[model samples]
Target: MAILRRQFAAALAVTGLGVGLAGCAVSQDRAGSTPVGVADSLYWNGPILTMNDAQPQVEAVAVRAGRIVAAGTRADVARWQGSTTQVVDLQGRTLIPGFVDPHSHLGGVGLQAIAANLLPPPDGPNTGIAQLQETLRRYINTSPDVRELQVAFGFGYDDSQLSERRHPTRDELDAVSTTLPIVAIHQSGHFAALNSKALERAGITAQTPDPQGGVIRRRAGSREPDGVLEENAYFGALQHLMPRLTVEQSVGWLEKSQALYLQFGYTTVQDGRADPGGVDTAIAAAKMGKLKVDVVSYPDILTMGEGRFMQGPYYSRNYQQHFRIGGVKLTLDGSPQGKTAWLTQPYLQPPAGQPASYAGYGVMSNAQATAQIEKAFANNWQILVHANGDAAIDQMIQGVQAARARYDSAGTLQDRRPVLIHGQTLRRDQVDKIKALGIFPSLFPMHTYYWGDWHRSSVLGDPRAQNISPTGWVLAQGMRFTTHHDAPVVLPSSIRVLDATVNRTTRSGQVLGPEHRVSPWIALQAMTLWPAWQHFEAEHKGSIEVGKLADLVVLSGNPLTVPHAQLIDLKVLQTIKEGVVVYQAP
Candidate 1:
């Protein structure tokens, strides 16, 4: 690997090809001093997984001016070769279209980059409450920024995987800090635990009533908040406790987040839920020429309803400096792993302080949700709804149906491509409705690996658990669904997304839903082709074909031919965006 890196680097240096980000100098002109029919780069000598159904694999692909100029046999494409062209020898590796994110928060993933990691095994070291506390303490002690902020925030802690199998108490967090405020967000991001001082900082008290669609988990048999907040309660507290970042810090975090995505071979990513402020920050980053890969942001519809940002140049399908406001986002419910996702059926074991008949509740009433959807449709804005549980999915369906009925007289509302994110508990009956209504389902099947056991034993139990995400039913209906990592909930690891989508393997080595598992080829399409269509970018971004943007990823192994159990072992060796090498493995 070291020798390969040195050789690649030496070759680039000799060819005068500077390896940097999107802003780096590269020859893009086809009519200037450069030859008209010449290629800038050529990739060949290994497997090429083109997501396009026609000519799925090719012997060679040629790129020039950030577009694929030719893709065919080596003998056929060699005509485009020129003296200055930089040839990339695959050396038995695999090349595929760059991944297009279906759902995730790049801004939240940026925040995750700066905060202490509290995720459990395979991602982080927080396997128990003690380890979590220790991790926070270490972060606070080591991070100068956290000390300056005077509030220590940690992300991705899952109570289900902890030794105690419960959220850390205020007292437990207090053990780490009493003077400095502390906030620990649940792995699902729907829940959070705050120390007493942090709770005070957020102004939560015993007298405070639970907010609508949210819960303040209290002490046993008492009204006193136990530091745990769910849904709206957590969202509110988080807003109050979040530290403000300077422009430089915000842009730096965005770059760091993009770097993480690039490392995992994502050339196009989604900021699935963005606020006005986040959109502004992304614009600033783009203006500074800092973005290497394309970023599509879906601002929260509840906050910005057909706002001025939608009227800007950044709102178009074509990226302005690699950033655009693709659409609006609406979140209907919370996370299933946290037991707060609105569900039609009662939870098998309710969280503490909830009744046995407790099924999670939606963030808004059906009328309110429908009105928002109507507003989105009225403006012809594409909308993405975050719905996890079946009940939430029901409300989403109702909202879409109402909106389409009112505004789709020409039968063209389907062209808007409304998306349903994280349909983890989608019912078999709802599959046909989703297909009929043109709801693009962007599911997080990675939940199978991250929280499959918890859902089986605590959240839903038995048969209900086996059908989570329900990829098979969508396939059965001859429909395509996109899969996502929902980053910050999980790292934006593309290989893990592929592995979980294809295997449905849990942390305990159990195949959670054998029936829902897909072939590696199908999984590739979900991450690449289907998601590109989801983002309205299929024409230029999905597959490796002539005239498409040269957005591609080089992998250590071929996904289709790799042993089923060894998918996780595959690595992203290099990420190329628009014929330029943006990220190469070190």
Candidate 2:
């Protein structure tokens, strides 16, 4: 790759910015004389953590029109400052390249914006039926839009703690909202609890059998279906009822989500799932120049009909300026927490009386997955498949291998780099397979922190539990890796992800799978350079190099030196996109 050094400086000079700090101190010349070119903005006086290997640290940087002009000593950058250039004195803060989240549901974040203030039931083990009922009651009674269906989300209930040791039944939700439809999505997004009204509105009844790739939980001792919906079944019912919200309605939410990401130091995000309408919305926002963050949208292949979505990176002429449609996304399996992750082994303890069904199976047949991937590869499309269980990961790898054999026969598959998103339960053998096939794993190691305790106690049990989110194993296997929060599934916070990867701490403060923890620098790369490489944008983004995009986040403290547990609390003091300050902390 050809690295252009100081191209931005030349461009800035052409734009009439002078080539020295003296020009910055002087006023514009009169008589219609155009001034010389220089820097548009300068940032100095900080520990600049450039991800670039050549120049890992710098005292200052110069930017001109959204790209880095120069990155070197303060004096070197000062030469690029012109009359109108904006200067930011970092006051010795720590600055790093803006974070890039490899996998997230951006549209879901937009949806959260619509009802952000509406508190959902408490999450995790402490969430009881009584507490949930009270929270829902309060939302129903006090929210201004009570007449509308009360749709509360983000609820987590430990199967071990519930009185029934099962999801809240439709009857329980019916007790709260018979007149209105209520859908409470599980925290994992694998299951949901819908009221009877919602069930009826979706036309689901006791007679309806589980769909091919999903399940409908039925009440015990009765033929009636309960409110709990699993896997694609929940998605099917909800997809039908989800409002066809207009693009205008989505803007507010999108902006809210963007702000949250910026506050957490993210500049670019790969939206893992996007509907056609959602893509159009993002594109429209970009076209209108309203988008503050760079978003790479991948259409949801499952919802868009398999084999139909665009296969590889499809960029706009101004992709770096705003938005781009990068690839197609697929879900190979369901959530492990919900006991639907398509594992080879059965759950050690299946719910009482329910026959030990293997923790479900792949959403797509192996042959079908292979066919889909082959077609996508032929079309030069990058593919990202969500595979959370060992079985699912194996199946996905087999499909990818088949695709490589067929479409990559000449050893020139192009750098499509099909990704195994959320390779959370990867097996040792599969790591070599992934490396051989040139596939990347965008691991969700944050699971180790968010659900580590539950994973230890209930989900994976002892033997398999320790293997969750094996970051150290991935690196040792010589495979490139990226990590993400899958935001809206979890908030899009790189600090949280960094902490989880570096510390491997559970919610209860116990360090789980200590061997899996990686160093802070490696974890940072997973969130930044690795993701950029996965998206094929490393040439222009990711690191803080001379020619890279001037996207950065100024932090209150150096993340590398902060206490591991306090990493999550690291405040993003300012977020700069293309050298323009987009967010500033109060």
Candidate 3:
């Protein structure tokens, strides 16, 4: 892998070319010197939200060699325009910095695209258990990939959204296919429902004990397997059932995934928890020039550890062919909507067959979590931990506190920028500690739209549900945090993210937490500027500023001026990465 990385770098140096639109040239440097060429593109006559506090708005912007050379009034930007420049008239649309994904799985998004979409309303057609089964059957019969893989796989089925108000059982999936091993993943990505064949193939029997930090759910009052696997159990079974994809297949998924992001106006995306195969796929795709947007992958620290790949040339802030390994990801708990997040307080309504005291469970022991965190600190690697519940958040906070105490004198702890991903159940007290520890909060406020009603009634209950994703609390502490879609949990729709962050409205039309609502401007900053800083790329990629990469998005409506309720109606007209139009809405 080291040799391969070195060769990739050498090839990039030899090519002396930039990853830009055809017939255009861009410098690889973030803030490169002026090229001899005239402006490649000149954009004006639109609302430009710079996201740069120094210059919150601009009238015109000029792009030369993929960097913003001029951004100000029309006269100032027109200075760089030439006969060859492509003058773009925005025609009253809104132009803003391209969306940056703070925490999401790029590869998983691709997988979600190819898998049978078992999601509910507004995303997929899986309205009930019967619909989910029928969808899988259709995929098995029609998708060549499924036929080739010989396993019927589906994703994004939320029991809470289904008409039946429950997960499809082993027998239910058997109706789809008894011979083929079928796997249906929960929308949370924390659980899986496998058919009987899949269980048999995975060697999961009625006698199989639940794995540590995971659960193999049983039939009502019986030891018989019920086809549901939670947390580690689901992860392990998935590893066994999922077939390895060919390089071509992996590249195809990468292409499709980025296209999805482009349509959503995201130019800088993330592969939040990449495995070895995922890293390899990304590298191969980069070498093939398959990546259009900036892809920053954070390999799983617990499994991948500080291997040679972690120490490779790709592990830097700079992009190598539009891809780089930003840091490492640590998942301390499961999803809150799945009722699997490790919470301090007992769940208001636990999963079936569980005690009233159930508050889910942690993925690892406190000692284990601290050791992993300390190791990252010792290695000077920025860590992003997925902690949704307050108990999990507590574990992360205590772990960081311990590591900081040990590494502070050595200077390894300074400006490390540790991130807390998906702080859905984060307590107000924990917010202060996070701010004090300098741990960046990359929150998931979109939950207010997708699962707020479920949370209010079943998961966290009333006041606690209202506090999920708590953006207002972070602001009260004078801290900045980023918001995310956690794509595949839902589509990577930046508009939906903005709407949920700004409105905090539930599916039932009630405001889940009016106190936690933020202005659209603040939401935009969280998506663009704050997330870029979280990934340590704020110097060049986040806002629209001179000497920064010309990464911008065009929207049909100005988010700042649009009626608050109509925010979700805003459409992505175009997505530009480094001055190149990657996606223009049809």
Q: For this target, which candidate reaches the highest lDDT against the unseen true structure?
A: 1
The TM-score measured for candidate 2 stands at 0.89
Q: Score candidate 3 by TM-score against the native.
A: 0.93
Tens-place lDDT per residue, model 2, 1-586, is 0111233233234332233222222222111223234777776656888877677789888889889988897656766766566655565688899998899988877665443222222223234666556656666776643444345433344444455556777888778778777776666777888888888878899898888778888888866887888888998897766765556666655777888888888999777769876776787777677788889988876666643335323443238347888878878889887778878877766655557765666787898888778867887878898899889898888888788877776867567889998887888888888888888888888887777777778777775777787777888987768888887777677778888888888778888777788877788888888899988889888988878898888887777787777887777877888877787776
lDDT (0 to 1) per candidate? 0.88, 0.74, 0.87
**How well does model 3 score by local distance difference test?**
0.87
How many clashes show up per model?
0, 11, 0
Maximum-TM-score candidate? 1
Question: Cα RMSD (Å) between model 1 and the true structure?
Answer: 4.5
lDDT of 1 by residue, 1-586 (tens): 3433343444334323355321122323122222348888877668998988889999878899999999887656656656666666666789999998888899999889888999998889988999999999999999986977788989999999998999999999999999999999898888999999999999999999999889998999889999999999998898889888888888998999999999999999999879887898999999999999999999998777448888989989899999999989999999898888999999999987689999988999999999988988999899999999999999999999999999988656458999999999999999999898989899989999998988899999989899999999999999999999999899999999999999999888999979999999999999999999999999998899899999999888998888999999999988999988889887
Task: Provide TM-scores for the models.
Answer: 0.94, 0.89, 0.93
TM-score, predicted candidate 1 vs. hidden true structure: 0.94
Q: How many clashes in candidate 2?
A: 11
* Candidate 3 least-lDDT 10 residues: 23-32
Q: Write the per-residue lDDT of candidate 3 for residues 1-586, one digit (tens) a residue.
A: 3432342233234321233222222222211223334787766667999999899999978898899998897656655655555656566788999999997899898888889999998888878898887888889989998878888889999999998878889989888889999999999999999999999989999899999889999998888988999999998898889888899988998888889999999999999889888999999999999999999999999668446668888999899999999889999999888999999999999988889999999999999999999988988889999999999999999999999998887545498899999999989999999998999998998999999999999999989999999999999999999999998789999999999999999888999889999999999999999999999899998899999999999899999998999998999988889988889776
Off by over 4 Å in 1: 1-36, 410-413
